[model samples]
Target: MTGKPIDGGAGVVSRVVDVADPADPRLDDFRDLNSVDRRPDLPSGKGLVIAEGVLVVQRMLASRFTPRALLGTDRRLTELGADLDGVDAPFYRVSAEVMAQVVGFHLNRGVLASASRAPELTVSQVLDGAATVVVLEGVNDHENLGSVFRNAAGLGVDAVVFGSGCADPLYRRAVRVSMGHALLVPFARAANWPGDLEVLRDKGFQILAMTPDPQAATLAEALPPRAGQPVAILVGAEGPGLQEHTMRASDQRVRIPMSRGTDSLNVATAAALAFYERDRLRTTVST
Candidate 1:
């Protein structure tokens, strides 16, 4: 027997289009997502950005990335409810089995949103009117990058700048891990590595490079007053701190106080501390 359609509440409209054949061309964009070459989001390929699960899908709806299409079970449609209202994307309703066959994985999350990537933002664009930002280098781990974006969003970071060797924040895994904050968090890639530090410096931002060096100032001592002033927190990948030249370019090197021999915190955690310190100082000054 077929299962009853899922419904969220009264007066909420959710359009459902029945899709049975996995090979239906209408599902092309959602097919073979596991195939290395055919998988979307590859820079050299079709590069469509995908959002999975309910939270990420909702985030995609609120972000600059506009959804082109949505494929999911009626259950998810009901859950989405008013969230999908006025969305231009068509909802391609499919059974759980068919969706698993098409995507090459059972998406327990039940909902997916696909959006064409918008134009890349420039460093100036992301930095403009910002009071706090995070600069990352060699953070190639999608999970870490996603966590950083999540932490940034929760902790009041205004933007994110990728200095070099960072992963694509728009990657499906990153977007999902970030809970879709990667889409909402404005970011830019530096055209020139260390040289770009000069641009931020010229904008009156105090660049604070996070480090484990005992000699560096602690987060409490290093962060400047916010007072509407711009600040950039420079963070490198876990293994390698910021590049030597990049560190030299910054105005100061800052370290999180940790137990002796404990090394350092995760990049995202460290960034959260920096953001917290900045926020704390900003609040203290105002009080």
Candidate 2:
């Protein structure tokens, strides 16, 4: 059945089309989301960014990515409310059964939006005017990567810079785990890996590489002294931490104080602590 014009939110009318067929060509962007080879979010494949659930979909609307199409049930459409007012894409209204059939899973969130990947920002672009940024290396775990974005957004990180061996931050799973903060936070890839770190240094950012080495200065000692200065907190993967050369690139090696003889923390947790300390110190200094 063809869609009728409806008040999507406030007084604005949204282009809502009723879609009953799971095989409809327009639904292709959201089809088989769980299929390993056919997932639209594969950076190596369709290169689309998929936002699932109402909250993430709202974030996507406010982000750099403009949705190409949206597929969701009527309940979700009403839940999205005014967020759809100015969106130019068609909202493919479907039944819950059809949504599950098209996406190949029962999405409890009941809504999804598909957008083409936005152009990547350069390291300099994200770092421009930034006071604090997080640099990551070899953090291939999607959930951990997402948590870093979420923490970065909440803890006053100005940007995120990816070094070598990092996963795509826009991957659907990463975006979901980040609670959509991955879409809102500015991030850029280091085109030159450790070499690009020189860009941060040249811009006057004091790079603090995170580690568990007992000899390293604690976060309290490392952050307060640099409170008013531009800083970059560098975190590596869970087990290996930063490479020796990467650690050498930093102005300081810092560790979170631990008890019970614990050697290290999860990459995301460690990053959160570092971010919080840096923010706290900066706040204290400013106030």
Candidate 3:
């Protein structure tokens, strides 16, 4: 049944169902969000894409990921008032206390939306018509992965490619940390690891592997020659950097110049630097 109607002003026609029982089976999708084994976002769990907070939930609504349902307080429902118009899913309106009981935590975000996982995109699909893509290797930290997506969105990256040893970008924490850009950004995992990099090369992309090695050329040196061409910035996990073979697969090794004693940056920070450098060069050349 379509739930009760909420007069979320400004044409919000969301199906607002008031759910008081924290144990209601219909709320299963959002139950025990903190459970490592039960959280809906885990690939091993329900494999659902869960969006937390009003902004992320709003993005989930606007993204390719369709929300099957949303759970939040009445305040959030009103805040999302206009954005909820025309959504087919039900918005389970619950009290803050009940939300805490159901999710196994005091979720201060005050809103959550759940969507079934969308079909995975192909490497070719993400790379299609792309100028600047960020490729990640061994970046297993969800927060760092999320930050990369955030950085990519803010810094003019076109897409993201996941290499071996990366974390699930759709993980709940990743989605939250990315401020929902994870939902908006197009990304795909490599089917052939370093072998698939040949596809980027075939498409005329110059791949620059990011490293901490002082001997490597800086971004300013390596990027200017390729200013008018397509480029792929490759970054790895924090400590080990890119895998040796992955490094060999790249066309150039580049580094961000550092201050007095700094040797390396966080994976996300390093990726941001690379993204910013590429964007700076692109903007400079275009004008």
Candidate 4:
């Protein structure tokens, strides 16, 4: 049931069960993972968060998500090594062919862990003692959302807040693209759009909206004044950018300088720049 077992007078045995039949009832959670109309990851659907690959599966093991089951080949079970130790989940060991038939694909990652979705957190819960946060609007693309989360985790953004028109951060594609950061990073949806933004402001966070307008202040110029205060970086979807009302609600608008002919950067890229700048300023201030 775990990577390794505690010595009960002897070495702990791995709880890997050999499964030959793809249609076994135990494999139900992982069946037809690519189902277009009804995947298990959908909240209204099967309502599970799946972590694919050894690294992501390891992250799931350490995260708020507790895997109820893992499906993978013998090679992956060996590759996972000590990471599975003490894990309570059952590792359903299957051959590549059986895994392929069960999941309806030959996922090269080889290992998949399924865990129940944790209850959603509120904006306030994620912001406890958090100095930097990213607020997203209309960023419905899974890859872009994933990249933003990866950036946030790497660049010191403390949490992610989703405003109206944003995609589900927990989507499988987004989680995979984020390299599992979508599961690791703290995120909450704004029950009310522009209105919930005010909640962040009320928490003493200086909301800086990312915009391409020539009138907006550069990141360097805008971030220092807010150095000691909590900061929220607002980013919109790539093409449409921030909604007008969202922009107006922001305490300040910040932009990255770019070449004249170049298009505005991707939302994730822009947010990364903003997050990096905020991180730098806080570092300088702390030092």
Candidate 5:
């Protein structure tokens, strides 16, 4: 079941097994990955978190979630190179056609890693020492949820808080869209919406709810100095914005300035701007 070394000559430790059969029992974790009713990523199903493509697979290798196994073509294995060093997981090398047969589609990423879901962090745990965090509510779209994670990573947002009615961030589509940042970023779900906001307040966070109200404080004016304090940027779904009750729980309401006739921004875009503004203000005040 073992194949030759993919790269780096003689010292390779990865056990590469060439499996041509799609129905092979060893490949069960990757079979029928696209089946809506039986996808392995479903929390109700096998509950495994999958990282697709070389970049995400590498990110998973670095994250707390350790891969139980990998399925990829020989080309992708060579591309992964020494990143597989000490991975402690078997690499199931297969042909592209075999991979397509197993996954139920042609996955252009050419690589996949399956890992078990790690225990989720608590709200307080993710918030520890966080200078800025994004709180989301009613964002049920998987792609939007993924975009928020990507934005959070790129814009220096410290953590994410899921209020209610949000999509599972670890869903395969969401994880792929986030470029694996969904796995790297710390996040937690609030046990109680709006009420748990009080906990953030008690922790010295200035909660600013992002809304389309032109009358609200501008993003620049909303973010306060964040030296010894923290800020929570709250956003709801795109069209609905923040719920009335959720908005009322915040310390203040904030809006992004827009051109005339434009009153709203996509939820994730708005959150990124808030994160960027907060980081900008923190840098300015610190300097």
Candidate 6:
């Protein structure tokens, strides 16, 4: 269903279609979004990629994931403004009550963009010309995984690699939590677990596995010299950390210097610190 034109600002034109019926087939992609085991975006099921909130939707517009359609309130349509000018997706405007009924909950984010899952990339594809990358293992928490992607983008990590047991980075909450960086950041799942470490190694990346073990070399001591050398900062879930095999596979095992007796930082935070350290070292050497 097409929408009527709303008072979009100069350079912005918004199509606002009123969605009265919650069960309308046009809104099927957004229906029951909160269903625990039945959501359409589930990778094991319909495998759609959902971008929640205005920022995520904006990122979706900028990323490779092209939104098939958008469903939101009038306020959101206004908020989106010029961001939607060239966007090809339809905007299904609906009342708050009807939206809540369709989505199966009150979505304060007030907007969502759904897209079909794009084809997956391989390890080598993501690693091409990457000078800095973050490799994750056993990071099954969507929020933590999302935070890592956000940190990677802001701190200059070029790409992300998922080792075994990592969560689906495209999960709805993860995409929302990453501020949509998850959609933009290039990533690949390891086809052979720690075996892929050799691929990164052969590509000249210095793999530094992050660890809490106080005996490991500090980030300052482990990072490479500034000649634009390739580096991979490997991180694992909070408690288990990098598997022994993964650690053994890496070129170096590094630790962030911390106060005595303190626990390690969160996994994503730890990855950010490593990325920051790498950037800082590069800057210091360049100057």
* Backbone clash count, each prediction separately: 0, 0, 0, 4, 0, 0
Q: Write the residue-wise lDDT of candidate 6 on 7-66 in tens digits.
A: 743345545467899998888889899898889789988788998888888899889999
lDDT of each: 0.85, 0.91, 0.89, 0.87, 0.88, 0.87
TM-score of each: 0.92, 0.94, 0.94, 0.93, 0.93, 0.92
Q: What RMSD does model 6 have?
A: 3.8
lDDT of 5 by residue, 147-225 (tens): 9999999888889999989999999999998999999999999999878998798888889898888899998776754
lDDT of 4 at 225: 84
* Runs of candidate 2 exceeding 4 Å displacement: 1-11, 281-287
Query: Which pairs of residues clash in candidate 2, taking residues 3 or more apart in a chain or in different chains?
Result: none
**Candidate 3 residue runs with Cα over 4 Å from true position:** 1-11, 281-287
Location of the lowest summed lDDT over 10 successive residues in candidate 2 = 1-10
Cα RMSD for candidate 5? Answer: 3.5
Q: CA shift at 201, candidate 1, in angstroms?
A: 1.4
lDDT of 6 at 250: 85
Off by over 4 Å in 4: 1-14, 281-287
Backbone clash pairs for candidate 3 read none
Query: Once model 5 is optimally superposed onto the true structure by TM-score, how far is the C-alpha of residue 67 displaced, in angstroms?
Result: 0.4
lDDT score, residue 32, model 3?
Answer: 94
What lDDT score goes with residue 64 in model 5? 82
Please write out the lDDT profile of model 3 over residues 192-269, one tens digit for every residue: 999999999999999999988989999989987887999999998999999999999999999999987877788898
Steric clash pairs (candidate 4): 1-15, 3-84, 3-85, 4-85
Model 3 is weakest, by summed lDDT over 10 consecutive residues, at: 1-10
Clashing residue pairs for model 1 = none
> At residue 173, what lDDT does model 6 achieve?
81
Candidates' RMSD to native = 4.0, 3.7, 3.7, 3.3, 3.5, 3.8
Q: List the residue pairs that clash in candidate 5.
A: none
Candidate 1 overall lDDT versus native: 0.85
